[model samples]
Target: MRLFSLRTLLVCTALASCLGMVGAQAATKAQPAPKPSGQKVAMLGGKFAFTLPKDYVKGPMEEIDAKARAAGVTGSLYMNKPAKRVVIITETPLPNDQKVGANDKPTLDGIIADTLQQQQSSYKDFKKLGEKKIVRKGLGMRQLDISGSVDGGRVLSTTITAAYGKRTAMVNVISLAKDAKAHAEVVKGVTGGK
Candidate 1:
């Protein structure tokens, strides 16, 4: 028969518990940090270029092209982020023979209206965060913040529409997660620097 002393048993149990706690902590510490959405974002074309977080990746500009085609509009640019990435959508109003509208400048209402049409989604989904004037490097600009979800909970996007002259450009920065604060920072960086 083998017998263990009480002191030995106590010491062994304590060591085992300590090891278990350490192992649990180590497992947590070993886990990788969550990755950024890698959505594509736009920067103001001026003295410098600003961008979204690394997790955000650029989506195809094809949607912009499609909108231009459907609206019978010309010379429009669209930039989208990768899947689940936030995107910025921009539209420009230029002299196009196909366009029946007559507006010297792009209006916020008009732009948003077109966006709903192009995306084939109703404006009801967007919760408007209001409007503000942005002045960057002595250049006066205006921007609007809008956000909503898409793709059956797979993709969520926050779009910041910024207009310049006869040309309008929108940047849709999106992610699988909702991030109002980060989106505001992105809008600030894009609007303030441009």
Candidate 2:
């Protein structure tokens, strides 16, 4: 067994604290992944791909699409179900305008926060697993874990938000009528950042 010196102990504790702070900073700070702003590429298991909203940012070229695929979700739909419908939304960070200040928040982050707030109206069961810092497609990102139910069914939701310069995205994954744990697992797998 190796001896434990006071200096060594202090160093280890300091390192652990620094690591924790880094994680916390990463969780709240902006990420580095560029949103898919240009050509609409096939995403997630070849289910579908169309021109994203010009204002919308894009995810990393790789797993962002892959995560969408695993979620078994397709393009955004115009209609909403009356009794019960599972809603999934994904957002990517857009390029920033140089005129804007760095302190400006990403649009996608706003969207996700809005969606979560709106969910308060319809969802009976609401719980947040909190936020985590993640890396997707070699870019820094944030993964938010949310759980709840709408129309008497379970919903497992995950949002991957990326901030590239002035833009940010919140990729949402919502599931229905299934075990919350299982649903979250699927969503994480689909988003490709978990």
Candidate 3:
């Protein structure tokens, strides 16, 4: 199954409006070093932070939102584009009526299963690459990898989802299947890898 549908994944976050245009412009013009410092950049008024690898530029939010709208998911989108890889961060508030306990494995698993079903119906060549459940910094998280052909090219996608109270965060990394390994570090940085 294709691990991620970029368009679908795009709407999963609510932080799109929080992405500053000035920062996005500067990120595009700046030449990142070969190895970035791996510093966490605070986003959404300190709700969360992400570390973009050196040499990756944040894409304009407007453009990303337009693409996401076309795909039918609406949310804030933080996209970092390196030479060969794309990492996207999305956050959206859970429905006001929804409540997820800290140890709610059944609820979390159901969410993931729904996502997988959506992918299976949306992509022609979706394949489940791998997945695992882990606790990161005391939060329950799920990591998934999947591959598929989109727009006639093979793509590999890695997605990490963490739910905290009434909010959920999802980070998606997409790369050419052959180049996915090269971007592993970038993905780890954004996903808060151990």
Candidate 4:
């Protein structure tokens, strides 16, 4: 039973550095965290909301935080057992000292490139399936689809990154490569895409 840990995948997906900063911020924050209302999980002070899948089980934030701490990444985890899929939502604050322009292309591009490199090094027979720039709910996001072999089975990873104000939210989905189409549909459903 080779369980492909999403925590491990997130660490190798270039989210560790950004997430490390988020972890530090979390420790120093004085305000109490807000709990999710119903099916929507609030992120970035309610600037973002992720609609949970109807059939997926949501893990406790404590467990998610502990895993992130162990992996040096920050994110909330949602899992669908029958589908063998994991969806993670991570938020990282942009550097406060520097002035970031609206829709900062260079910064986002750098993150994308770094993530691609990390994926290549982390997985066996890694291949970039496709990538595209898209707008979701008026926010610009970069989406990447990557396929690789994990524990003798092919896996597909889809990562979507969007910048909002002084923070960036990343949503990553990992599923068996054989379920690529189904996984895509799942993403579309969760994101409210046609």
Candidate 5:
């Protein structure tokens, strides 16, 4: 088993990044993968399963994204066109040397910093809204919030990352700033907030 890398996590959210910008830039030139027909997504051989919101149809969906192949990243993307919202779930194996332990505050901090920097560079007018640590379903997770400009619109995003064995899973929820309330609900749903 292995651990996840920064590159892998980045690939996981590229869709939300690019699509949020209305293709202001291409994060990866990956060819489109078959679209998933259902909103229910099963990953890691069904070890993890999530049912997305009704309107969030799967994205140029793929079992493994080509651009992220070398990094051992696999993901599923869901897009809610009517609301211009996106949800991305990514799983990646981290190298043994880079394994992140549950109490690895330093490692988690570095990851949060790197992810924030990546988002800042990817989105214009970027601002760090807030961040916090949360435990959901007995899993330790770090949640981050940020706002940035994309496609002449401001987008708000929340990312929740957790370590599972040698692999890491990252889930990102993105929406236009005008839809922050809905976006918060979406994030809360994933984080199991009341």
Candidate 6:
């Protein structure tokens, strides 16, 4: 059964934006880290703040396209276009009546399960890698390790989701699977591992 609305997991949370898949650009070189954006985005009503990495370019939330915005995704997006990598940090408001909370294990646990199911249903050749419950940035979050084929190519994805007081924040990193080391480093950096 679907624990959350289809909107919550709509089309892989903007991952379907034709990120120019992995195999096509398997030999792409790493672009030099770009200048940092000198701003911080506050989340969880100012309980947390995020700074975009110097290695990727930041695009306005509107760039995420209308479908994602309609699904209630409001946050930042970063991309290293030539490198075939994308990072989406989104803050989505949740309904007051749902089974959700920052500290609610059951809610998060169910989400991870349903999230995997949603991806399996959405992507072609979706594969489960590994996943676990983790604490990041002082919030209990669920992380998924998975891969699948999308519009442009196959990509590896590390998705971390956490809820706190009326809102849920997700850090989704999608990159060419061949750039495993680079992708893992970015995920670690953004999540602030415990």
TM-score of each: 0.46, 0.41, 0.68, 0.70, 0.73, 0.75
lDDT tens digits, residues 1-194, model 3?
21234435353221222222222443333323325454456533344466665455555444345554553333333344433456666655444446665545775676577666665665458899888786655567677788776545566777776666665566767665666655566666655664
Model 5 vs truth, CA RMSD: 7.4
* lDDT for each candidate structure: 0.38, 0.39, 0.55, 0.60, 0.65, 0.67
Candidate 6: residue 71 lDDT (0-100)? 62
RMSD to the hidden true structure, all candidates? 20.8, 20.2, 8.0, 11.9, 7.4, 4.1
Worst 10 residues of 4 by lDDT: 29-38
Q: Write the per-residue lDDT of candidate 5 for residues 44-119, one digit (tens) a residue.
A: 3443445566667676545455666677777767777666677878777744536655545665565677777777
* Local error of candidate 1 at residue 119 (angstroms): 8.3
What's the TM for model 6?
0.75
Tell me the lDDT of candidate 3.
0.55
lDDT of 2 at 11: 22
Off by over 4 Å in 5: 1-50, 61-67, 96-104
Candidate 5 is scored at a TM of 0.73
State how far residue 61 of model 6 sits from its true place (Å).
Answer: 4.2
**Clash counts for all predictions:** 29, 6, 10, 0, 5, 1
Once superposed on the true structure, which residue ranges of model 3 sit more than 4 Å away at CA? 1-48, 63-82, 101-103
Which runs in model 6 stand beyond 4 Å of their true positions? Answer: 1-18, 21-27, 30-41, 61-73, 97-101
| Candidate 2 positional error at 59, Å | 19
**For model 6, where is the 10-residue window of minimal lDDT?**
1-10
Per-residue lDDT of candidate 2, residues 4-51 (tens digit): 121122222322332343434433322222233433433322322333
Per lDDT, the best of the predicted structures is 6
